[model samples]
Target chain A: MAETVKLLFSATRETVYMVAVSVLIASIFGIPLGVLLYSTDRGRILENSPLNKALGTIVNIFRSIPFVILLIMLIPFTRWLVGKSIGTTAAIVPLSVAAIPFMGRLTETALREVDRGVIEAAQAMGASPFQVITKVLIPEALPSIAAGITITAINLVGYSAMAGVIGGGGLGDLAVRYGYQRFMLDIMLYTVAILVVMVQLIQVLGDLVVKYLSKHR
Target chain B: MIRIRNLTKVYTSASGTVKALDGINLDIEKGDIFGIIGLSGAGKSTLLRCINLLEKPTSGSIEIDGVEMTGLSPKELKEMRKKIGMIFQHFNLLSSRTVWGNVAFPLEIAGFDRKTINEKVENLLNLVGLSDKARSFPSQLSGGQKQRVGIARALACDPKVLLCDEATSALDPETTLSILKLLKDINEKLGITMVVVTHEMNVIKQICNKVAVIEKSRVVEQGTTFEIFSRPKTQTARNFLKSMFICEIPEELKAKIKALNGNLAEGRVVKIGFFGEITAKPILSEVVKKFGVNANILYGNIDNIQGTPFGTLVVQFEGKNGTADRALSYLQDIGLDVEVVEIG
Candidate 1:
């Protein structure tokens, strides 16, 4: 029982680390990618159809790939990146790669929801394209973008669990090794309970932030 | 001051090509509340946008204060745009920003320091009468209040010219008047040139010193507000001022006219327009007495336009010996516009 407690504690820490670091990395790359996708589309500030289409196709290909297959497919790149093919740290690569496109698509949608008139108002005031994005577009879309980030974070939590399939250590790895392989139903139930609690906490916290950021109320 | 010479804008879509503006020419003096009045789809908005190069004109030249707009580089255009502020029909205030932040947005774009931005925003908010609502978001304001915020934001850069794109179309009648009053006050206090584009004739009537009537992507008429109101040359201008003219012959009057069967010996219906000192002089009565014609007044109303009293009267002239024709000619001779409505 003591050993089980220690394993659960370590597993929870690994899952938190995987999800947090992966989300952080995904956001850094994904936000600019999203802004590029939005601004390069036809009729936008930085309109360039060819670049927008190319970026769109790349994001779509990544987004359409199944997470399980993506994990295996990214093994070589992951090994090259982190000097290891399997572990919580290495799993972040595949998780972040999959989430980047997802996050980008969502962030684009959030930005697209901003009013066109507001954007024109900014332009009329002599705002450069970069200034428009940073000052007007992003700030106006902040609440929706925050909501998108929340959804992306929740998706990362799920993806982090799947990272366990490749010897990536987390609660899912603990559950599979002890509950599935050793037939310990009680341990599996404990991991499921913890996952549900983690997801709930994330959702509640995200809603609070969204509510606070939303000035439309 | 703005001078637009043969400015044209052509729009092409997958469906076909459209000429949004064709050979528009205008000369607006400084401190003038110039109005572009047109019906929907007449391209007045496109013309207003052309001033700031928001929609680049397809051909011709636009010069503001002697600087050619069409030839300006992107950076120079941006600098030029900073001196020209615009307000939208939708009152496009940033939803996420407080009134203070919204007003400060233009100052921020102009790269003013934080202290200057604060002081400028405060002065602008006071100018627009939104000082108490500085901390409130746009969603918390009414349509009129939102437009006040829009005005405040537009004035933040101390722009020399202000463009109003149907700025009061979204507000109620009372609110529209209030906003117009504010615009007039701003124009008076700051001596800023203003270009207003609107379909509402009342908008032109209320504040415009100079008005250009646009029809079918072309400038049909351009003159002082009183000139256009007192003597509308084009059919479009006449149609727009129809409500102001009260030329609708009463049903009873129409029946009375129909009873005469186009007999020259009986009477004729004439619509006479009087402007400025003409309204004060009893010219219609004098014409009747001089021509030996009996005049029956059908409809008449005096309107004060730009401090000038302009009135229109529809009357039935009963006389023998071709005196009605002489009376009509005499009215036309004395600078009165006379149109034969019905010959009875």
Candidate 2:
């Protein structure tokens, strides 16, 4: 039982590391990707139909692949990135890749929800195309964008747990190795309990942040 | 001065092409309050948009302050747009921003230094009477207060031309009057050329020195507000003024006069429009005394436009034949514009 507690603590840290690194990585590229996808549509700010269509197709193709399949498929690339394909850092590669398209599409939806009249008012005030995006579009869509981020972050947590299926060394890996394979029911229930608690904390924190932001709005 | 000549705009969609503006020729003098009046979908808003190149005109020459705007490059056009301020019917104040921030946006766009922006925005907030609500967000404001923020924002860059696209149409009547007065004060104090587009005649009567009536994408008539109100040449203008309930009688009264067939004094409804001296002259009483014609006033509305007394009255004369005719002729001779609505 003491060994289980020690292992659970270590496993929880690994999962936190994997989720945090992947979410940070996904946000860095995914936000720009989403903005480009939205702005390059025909008659939009960037207004490149060909680029928009190609980018959209690529995001859709990636988004359609299952997370488990994506993780398996990215093994070689993950190995090249982190020098090993079976550890926690390696799991981040597939997780970040899977999160990119998901975050992009969600951010695009948030941007689309911004009022067109507000965009026009910015233009009428002589805002440059870049200023319209930075000042008006982004700020106006911020509340919805914050909500989208919460949804994405929650999804990434679930995805991080799934990473343990393939020897990624998180709570799921501990549960599968000691509980399922070793016939230890207590370990299985403990991992599940911990996962549920982490998800609850994420949800509460996300809601509090969104509520605070919407209040200022 | 803003000169728009031979302006035409066509909008093409997947369904079909619609001509929104056609051959719209207008010369709006600097410091004058101009109005463009039309019904919904009559291209009034479209015309206003074309002025700022928000809705680019298919063909036209728009010259403001000696610069032809239609031919400018995108960057140059954007630079030019900074001088042409616009307020909307919806009061398009940025919802996420405070009233001060909303007003400061344009100045910020123009890249004015922070200190200059603060001073100018402060002066503008005072000008529009929203200084007390500077920290308040748009959602917290009433429609009138939101528009006051909008007005302050539009004036932030010290624009030479201000375009109001039905600015007062969204507000209640009392709020509308206050906004109109603010606009009038702005026009007087800043001498910014104003082009207002609205469906209401009272909006035109309140501030516009010159007005153009639009119908079916054409400028049907253009003149001084007093001239348009006193003598509406086109059926569209007449119908428009009829809505104001000031110039023309109600349709029921018109039908009633049309149905009656009697002597000139008994049946004829004469529309008497006067400006200047006749408004003060009690001309109707004079006509009654001179001709012994019992002039029953059916409708009357008098207004002071630009410090000039202008009014219209529809009266049915009930007296002998030659006396009523001579009385009307005498009114015309005295320079009171008279139109016989239902001739007996």
Alpha-carbon deviation at B184 in model 2, angstroms: 0.9
Error of 1 at B233 (Å): 1.5
lDDT of 1 by residue, A34-89 (tens): 99999999999999999999999999999999999999999999999999999889
After superposing candidate 1, which stretches have Cα over 4 Å from the reference? A1-4, B250-253, B256-265, B284-295, B317-333
What is the i-RMS of every prediction?
A: 1.1, 1.3
Residues B218-271 of candidate 2: C-alpha lDDT, one tens digit per residue = 999999998887778999888887786566566777766776535343445788
CAPRI-style docking class of model 2 based on DockQ: medium
Q: What's the lDDT for residue A135 in model 2?
A: 87
- Can you tell me the CAPRI class of model 1? medium
True contacts kept of 2: 0.47
State TM-scores per candidate.
Answer: 0.93, 0.94
Alpha carbon lDDT at B24, candidate 1: 91
What is candidate 2's lDDT per residue for A93-156, written digit by digit as tens? 9999999888888788888877777777778888888988988888887777777777878798
